[model samples]
Target chain A: MNNNTSIIVTSEKLNLQTCYDFVKDPSCGGIALFVGTVRNHSYQKEVTLLNFSSYSSMAVKEMTKIAEQAIASFDIYKIAIHHATGDLQIGDIPVIIAVSSAHRGAAFKACEYAIDTLKETVPIWKKEHFIDGQVWVNTHP
Target chain B: MKIKVLFFGIFTDIFGKTTIELEVPSPINVVELKAFIIKNNPKSTALHFAVALGETYADDNARIHEQQVVALIPPVSGG
Candidate 1:
């Protein structure tokens, strides 16, 4: 449950196993993970693909801040956050967040909070491609 | 000097590029660059955005580095 237990990656090539293992330690007990994949539909429209772009540095910083805040607020043992940038097809793992804590309650809370904070604060934007057309939503983050 | 300015989401369509460059004097900060951009493109004033500097979120107090990659991020709808 030290500094090495956390990672923040924004790469085209993602190593899910590596990220999972990074926070997988024989600590207290529970290890909760959240893998956000691109869904095939959004609001009933068929989604073809998703293009995720991030202000890499800022996104990383914001993610780190979330991790730090979670660690401080919750009893989490370790944390890992990895997000993919570039073109992503349906079912692609766009974001992965793992949290380890002594108990399941803290793990679940921290994991959910981490992803929610990332969406709210991280400097990353995604474009949705539908069958009819594509639209860029939200330009005020 | 010149720097790379990236726009995400709807801003891309408005600016027509994932990235652009702002011509400005040396040693400009985030606020100054935003002001410069607004002055050049008054239409952009209607939009609210956030600036990201090399792995860190930038605000009005953030400093601009020479040749640094800056991204203008708009609100996102993805869950």
Candidate 2:
């Protein structure tokens, strides 16, 4: 684990300011952050809420791996990743990725890679509760 | 050998419980363990799933040992 990397999976609401604080470094010249929020609709359905579940142990492990990869792949000073579980309403933040680097290019690229890789590998699932019914998103074909 | 199986995401919905303990023969691989799970809980076969041994993702040929933490992982949708 990198000393500057922070990996968190929780049920509480995410705080963006904390993420910014975590990645703040005097030596870094630029910071990039990505915030993923619950959307109002999915597949043309009116989504009312989302309930998230995760294999906590593996989720953290995979998240750490992504952070480590980002640290090694990019010229970044620090990285922080936080994800939320349980029920969340539309417009609520579910995930946040922060990266700090000596240049804007590295910060931006590393931030994008972190979020993209996290979506593909992390063991977290979201079930959208529509007005009429609810279904786990992306579970089946 | 007794193995502990943990369910997550849609798998928990299919299994109707979070954790299950099963007794299988010794030296079982991940493929065989998945087969045993599907045989006992047929609904689990409906979704494409992967297995994780401890903190790492396990391939189908990976061997399962006694008291290892095993988890069923469905397709991920996190952002």
TM-score of chain B of each: 0.83, 0.87
Candidate 2: true contacts recovered, fraction: 0.80
Candidate 1 chain A lowest-lDDT run of ten? A1-10
Quote model 2's TM-score: 0.94
TM-score of chain A of 1: 0.91
Per-residue lDDT over A18-83 for candidate 1, one digit per residue giving the tens place of the 0 to 100 score: 677877778859889899988999888999998887666666677788888999999988888888
The residue-by-residue lDDT of candidate 1 on B1-79, one tens digit each, is 8888887777777777777776777789988887777677635446666677765567798878878887766785433
What is the C-alpha lDDT profile of model 2 across B1-79, one tens digit per residue? 9988888887777888899887988889999988777777756356577889977889999999998778888889887
Clashes of each: 12, 0
Expressed as tens digits, the lDDT of each residue in A1-141 for candidate 2 is 779899999999999999999999999999999999999988888999999888887899999999999999999999999999999999999999999999999999999999988988899999899999899878432
What TM-score goes with each of the models?
0.79, 0.94
Off by over 4 Å in 2: A139-141
Interface RMSD of each: 2.8, 2.2
True contacts kept of each: 0.58, 0.80
